[model samples]
Target: MIKIAVVGCGQIAQRWLRVLTAHPKVSVTALVDTDLAAARRLHALGQVDAVTATTVHQALALANVEAIVNLTPPAAEPEMTRLGLTLGLHVLAEKPLTVRAAPAQALIAHAEQVGRRLMVMRNRAFDPGYSAFVRSVAGRGPLLAAGETFVQLRAPGFRTAHTALADLGVHAIEQARRLTDAPVIAVRCTEHPAAHLAPHAGLVTLLLEFADETVVSWRGGYAGPGLRTPANGRWSADTATGSATFDGQRQLRVGDEMVELEPAAPGYELCIGDMLAVLTGGSITPASVSATDHATSISVLEAATLSLSTGDRIQLAGTR
Candidate 1:
């Protein structure tokens, strides 16, 4: 069995725990969090003989875990991943991997040199609801235009700078890239923090230009006025042949075929499952995570943030 440690006890950690505890070849050997109580709470529910520590260092010092599933926040991901790799542990990190692209790119190279598996959770690609959309886009010539919107209540931890763009916009960028054989090359963005209305960093409006001459407009934030659906998010894409729209509930309409998929495992569950399958000598048909692709997505968001400051379009330097 692959002994593993989960190094965060936040909203996402609980979801990962649900999937890990059920996997036969994986053992939940350690749980870590800055908040020991939260770690203890997770450990109590895991029903595994696990060590609970207040930090990754303490957990590694005490437990014989072979892998670490990093569920820490974006700001802490680079440091946590480096520490895990230094100890010769395979790492599966939750995305938006890090705030800065350079550190993230460096981590990818370091993991390759260390010969440890470093996988980012690019959950959208694993979702089945997008299958029809993928087919439709494949049949079409190329992606011409796209739009995606994300909104949620002002949750705790949304107050940090560019947190929303990094957290959710990463997914938007990934999904946008997924629609066609195109690379996003440039970005122009404008942010509306709307601080007087909320304590969090609010809405961000972005225009992404792609190598295939596709352009996608993106909007995402904690709490925003007048831009929301019955669902948490929604996306629409158009090509030469047909169009597609995903209603955030794992349902999509591709070229008039109204399709509502069954409640598939949440992307988080599927992503963690993929990571475990790889560890156990099983494989996902096409790998779900790529560090280079993630770097492009992160760099796009970085450009967006910089655009917020300078009020200009930012060009991405060679993502290939």
Candidate 2:
């Protein structure tokens, strides 16, 4: 069993605790939050019976863990992951590796320089719901075009300007890559500020043109004025042979057949399993999200943010 320290006992941390504590190969050795009260609340609620600390430094001292499950807010993720990587522990971080592309890319480079395993959690690819869809695409050839959407009544931490594209849209970008296996060549974005709130871009529509000539359009809502009615959710990817559609639930349809998926382990569980598999002699697959791809997702979002701010499509560097 790999001893793991979970950082940030907030909303995401709750999920981590539930999944990691029960896993046979994982040990939730420590929990940390900036607010001791919040950390204590999760500790008591979970009945984890483990060491708890209010900071990463303190947690590291107390727990002899081999990995860090970082569920901290987007801004804190890079530093937290860096601390663990610096200490030679593998890190599985939540989406949007950092607030910007450059920092995220820097972390990836640092991880490589130090020879550590770094993975960003993109569970949609591992979701059992899409297994048949994955199989369908095997015979169909390269993904031609794709779309991924996530509409929520409110997006967490998106109350600030230019945050919606980064906070929520990043996941969609990852989804597009997972299905399409292409890099974003160009991006066009349109965003609207939240109603009755500070000039935060609460809603965003992104057009990502991929290297495989597959264009994935994605969009979502944040804590804005108000969410649009019937203004939520959709994903469809087409190859020359066939197309697949996600019902935004667990259902996906390819051509005329439907593949229903029973709920598998929670995303965190699958993600931790993926990390441990690699750490314990599991090889990385072509389908897996790599450090480079993770960084590119942030870059695409950064381009979208720039596109929205400039009211002009941004052509990503080094793509045709």
Q: lDDT tens digits, residues 1-320, model 1?
A: 99999998877787888888898998888999998998998877776789999977788788889999988876677899999998899998888777678888889898888988888888875556654456656746656655556565556552464566776677777776676666677888776665665666477777888776777787777665566543325767788777878776767788888887676666666777777878788464235666667877888778887887899988886442
Q: Candidate 2 overall Cα lDDT vs. reference?
A: 0.70
**TM-scores for every predicted model:** 0.90, 0.84
TM-score of 2: 0.84
Candidate No. with top lDDT? 1
Give one digit per residue, the lDDT tens place, for model 2 in 105-141: 7888888888887887766655555444555665455
Where model 2 places Cα greater than 4 Å from the true spot, the runs are: 134-161, 196-201, 223-233, 238-241, 281-289, 317-320
Spell out the clash pairs found in candidate 1. none
Output the TM-score of candidate 1: 0.90
> What are the clashing pairs of model 2?
195-225
Q: What local lDDT score does residue 266 receive in model 1, on the 0 to 100 scale? A: 62
Clash total of candidate 1 = 0
| Ten contiguous residues minimizing lDDT sum, candidate 2 | 224-233
